[model samples]
Target: MPISSKIARQMEEASWIRKMFEEGVRLAGQVGAGNIHDFTLGNPDLEPPPEFVESLRDLVVRPRAGMHRYMPNAGYPEVREAVARWVREESGVEVGGKHVILAVGAGGGLNVVLKALLDPGDEVVVFAPYFPEYAFYIDNHGGVLRVVETDGQFRIDFDRLEAAIGPRTKAVFVNSPNNPTGVVYDAAVLARLGGLLRDRSRKLGRAIYLVSDDPYKKILFDGTQYSHVFRHYESSIAVYSHSKDLGLAGERIGHVAVHPAANSAEALVAGMTFAIRVLGFVNAPGLMQLAIRDVLRACIDPSVYQRRRDVLHGALTELGFECVKPRGAFYLFPRSLEPDDRKFAKVCLGKNILIVPGVGFGRSGHFRISLTSSDRAIEASLPAWREVARAYATV
Candidate 1:
């Protein structure tokens, strides 16, 4: 009689992470904001670089005629060309404006690509402990999500992935420097993945697209670099955003770069462009597209995040928490001190600490900690974190 059953079920599934954050906010009011250790969201707290700000200001003050008007559904020609040039340099693949389609954000870009690709009942493979929204995205296009778990270190398990491949499999979604787990997929692993896709495609007599979600591509730590998937996988679609890297998450601007060498590249790009329009995005925010076009070279300093990661990871591990030191992105997945992560998270809440249970990201026996908050938040939260850990130690 009210919302559709489909939506009701999806909402129930997606509520856990948001519920934690909301509870954290409600508790903050009760205990005073500084007393709660909230690590439930990956919202980056850093401001955009000075250049990005200047570019925005410049664009606003010296407005071009019809600057706010809609350009092409694929995005402004100049913006697409700029993005294509950057992709070419980074991926070492020759792509031009025609291969790029701009969308509201990485999430929107993914939806657009999925809309263009998935027929009803098609299967999409995803690695577990992934961004939970992926299930919703795949479902939006009438595709089923077939999940395969990652290795102990959160790296891709090639054997398991190979086994997951089947005739219905149309795409494999990858998020390197993954959201819940921050492990970066190395070049060697990417090469292997590419080879597998090639062989599988030949055997099945079909093409399996590689969808690379890369919002955290530029936020890496320890001098690590992201493996450009397009170089290894020809039938790859790179969904990228300036949200995490430029601290423009609220602006919602990103693009999808189709591999120039992909099979029927022009057709794929056209389909993505049409999908973006039909899905109601029409185009990415004009101001943000222009804001990011020239400032493609800019990034919020990774060192700031690196220092935060070092402090949190080192302090937690020293206090007896098992954590995989993240190489990119702003979240850390730490093994729960107790057997049931939900109960362990509740124990944390008792200590005025809020964290997402690992099951929210398709894993259990652990929890996720978003390190994107202010350094003051991390430093202030440490004592409470230690108290929670100590409580678990005794249990």
Candidate 2:
């Protein structure tokens, strides 16, 4: 009764993933953690890559003078320059320090972008089966979320996407190697998307920015081709996190890079820096900003996740759970045996196999299993997964 109705509604509407994660903790306690396979959270269990570890250690052992003091709301100039160099190499854009704004994490960086772009009731389009928190982030800045469903392969259907864009449309969010499906958006796909947005923006007579949530850009597998979002769209913004690639989820380090080619690009960066300060993020942690500057070239080997993906995807597919083979990231989205994903998720819970239902990702009829768990957890979960599949077949 003390809480506002808006928050209550948000609680009811989303965070199924976090709810399931909490449930996993409780069940793990009750059943002994070994008895439960938690596939709820995408929190990685991998150690930070050795290069990242070394960089942090060196910086910590010999701190720079005033290293702990506040930095430019945009970030340490040198660190931003380093990140700019990394982005230039990856995105093929000649970005400079002025183009980047460091932030607490991808989540914080997203909020910064949304705050900078949205006016009240402005609409932001997102792909279906997106990260659930996107809806919340949109609302935090008084923007509306418009979801456009993807095709069976979880790739964009341009017609559907175009239909979703209209007056009041401010931006479109692209998340490649997507959170639940783990499918990478290829260069061809991005090029097509860029074309669609360009035509639509021309008709609407305004810039429809493309904001990419690219935390998993470095987690590619099977020689997955990486497409720079900036390469495809001039009005694009890239928000990246060290959470996935560096296994620094808890460290909460990330950056936002406005496409150097974007119109009013300098003003956009200035606005984002203002948002960072007022949003109370102030800036990304100083130590992390400095530490990662030297280790931009290294990330956790994709093979570390490729092995887990192979084990999990192969076993699930073998057991008759239809799934699109994931080429990147560490999640598998498989069709739920029943159309009611929440009901099916409950059934998995009965077997101590925890998964987030597809509804959590703005899609239904499927559930997500995160490979961020240990190899032992994946191996152990298989028999239980097999039992669930067998039971569902008869039903």
Candidate 3:
């Protein structure tokens, strides 16, 4: 049987991050895993909090029947209610159980929201240097992805964004403490984006929604504050994950919170629930849903990530790589010394180090280094990085 054209096209454009990880594995096999410095994937090296594991064990071993069975297409009411309470407490918004939908993860939540809202050929606007998956998610539902360039530092360019929105624009995606750049959009910038969307919606006589992908909501450092988009834009939905925050990436648990004050909030939520069913998630894993209800407020300590960040940032800068000191998250986007970022990545690989080229994330002349490795890996990788920089310096 022949594969569909759409699936074939998507396969041709698979994530470079995954590609780098595969290459690293191959290199490791060829030249002993201990010798290669692989920082390609953002898989956290930290263990999940002991309390979380304990809670999971307690839930799984309990004598209650039907604990493993599917409950609702959205989720168990109690779990959704607990999550809604957390959102209300954090954002001071009036959210109820009806407004929350449990998803497999932030990735699943995003796809569900896109499938629920996007009609064929509808447009979704995203800032440049975004998480590459945003394009794939939009295209999965036959929506056109419109990428708007940001300022030199990757801050939102309001003028360019305003020009991109038109009658067909369905949603705008905002990821703070962003994946590639790690640049968090401040309050003032969010306020301007709110005004732009409001005015554009009025002019076009259609409501455009804001989709906030917030897996890194709690992974901040250096007193950085991430503005809640729902506070700035009324037509906002928060698709959040417990992966980065709780170190539960493999568990696949997250939610979509449709702002209570959003226009047609009820309809939007209903559509999302339906999408969750049709997309075959059915519901979030039963055990994880129960486990997160008790630990929604808990997160992996920022100090560990902070220490890793400090060491990596200092070493890279001293080696003559210009990197935007990340305010949050466990990744650093460093400008490549050479104009060809892919070539720069190749150079690093030649030194038994692996990183992702920034061209995959809509920017060239840069590369991403994940700071989620062990301290030993970071310590061992620096001299090799310096060596690569020196080689490029001569060229």
Candidate 4:
């Protein structure tokens, strides 16, 4: 009764990840916290890399005049320049600061993008098994979400994608080294997607933007190659966050980069800058912006995550759980023991194991496990995982 009816309804359909996380908290009180195996959130247990930590220490120890002052809505010039160089290196696109706008993180950058691009009733097509928050983000901008299910291997079903696009379609969003399912989109797949968008844009008489959320681009595994959106499509935008790569989740810093050759690229950047102000993010945190700028090339040595993935994925499969090994990101999405994933998650909960049901990501009969747990936590959870697996095993 206190909140708006809209938000009230939204809260009812809130993220299962948070739901399970809260469940973890509630259950932690009963069992010693150490006995709880909470794979609910994608939050890494790792600390920020030494490079970023030292950079922050240096900046803090030697404060400059106006370092904490309000900056341009786009961001500090030097920070933007640093991000631009990183963009050029990773995406193979010749981008400059003019093409970039800093934001409160990939989440906020995405909201800024939708705020700038979406009109009332516009449609944004998303693939199934997606990050659940995308639905809320699209609704925030008065856009309709059209979910197209991926193929068995989590690859885009091109035919479904073609059918999903209509005259009012504004954009197609993708997250590589995806959230729940860690499938990485390769350049070949992107090439096919670019061709499709080009053909569809001409037929629809509008440019349908390919909006890529690449917060985990640098957190790849097993030498997996990441395809940058700008390199695959001309009418595209990229959102990058320092959270995953730098282990700076609480810093709340990231940037949006519009493809230099995109349709009305300059105007798109300007609109996003304005949206940044109107959305109240104004600019990314100034101290974080400056700190990340100095360590633009630094990352948390993704091998750490790769090892985590191998440990979890191997143990699951060996125990008869079916899952695709994650090529990147710190998650393992495995098919649930039964047809109902919620039931499976409840079973996991019985063992003091916390995982989000895959139905939350628009899929059923699966569940997500975050690989951000420490070796100790994983070791402790193995017995519980085995116990749960046996509970569902055929007698």
Q: List the residue pairs that clash in candidate 1.
A: none
The digit string of per-residue lDDT tens for model 4 on 32-55 reads: 788899888788778889999899
Indicate the residue-level lDDT of 362 in model 2.
Answer: 84
RMSD of each: 1.2, 1.4, 1.5, 1.2
Model 3 / residue 264 / CA error / Å: 1.0
- State residue 42's C-alpha deviation in candidate 1, in Å: 0.8
* Tens-digit per-residue lDDT, 28-144, candidate 1: 889987788888878888899999999999998999899999789999999999999999999899989999988898989999999999999999999989999999999999999
For all candidates in order, the CA lDDT equals 0.91, 0.90, 0.88, 0.90
Question: Where does the lowest 10-residue lDDT sum fall in candidate 4?
Answer: 14-23
Worst 10 residues of 2 by lDDT: 386-395
Instruction: Give the distance in Å from residue 223's predicted Cα in candidate 1 to where it truly belongs.
Output: 1.1
Tell how far residue 75 is off in model 4, in angstroms: 0.4
* CA RMSD (A), model 4: 1.2
The best candidate by lDDT is 1
Model 2, 1-395: lDDT tens digits are 99999999998887676678788888988999889988877888888889888898998888889999987899999999999999999988899999999889999999999999899999999999999899999999999999999999899989998788989999999999899899899999999999998888888888899999988888898888889898999999999999998989999999999998786788889899999999998999989888899887778878978999999888888888889998888899999989999999989998899998999888899999888888887899988888888778832
- Kindly report which residue pairs in candidate 4 clash with one another: none
* TM-score of decoy 1: 0.98
Ten contiguous residues with the weakest lDDT in model 3: 10-19
lDDT of 2: 0.90
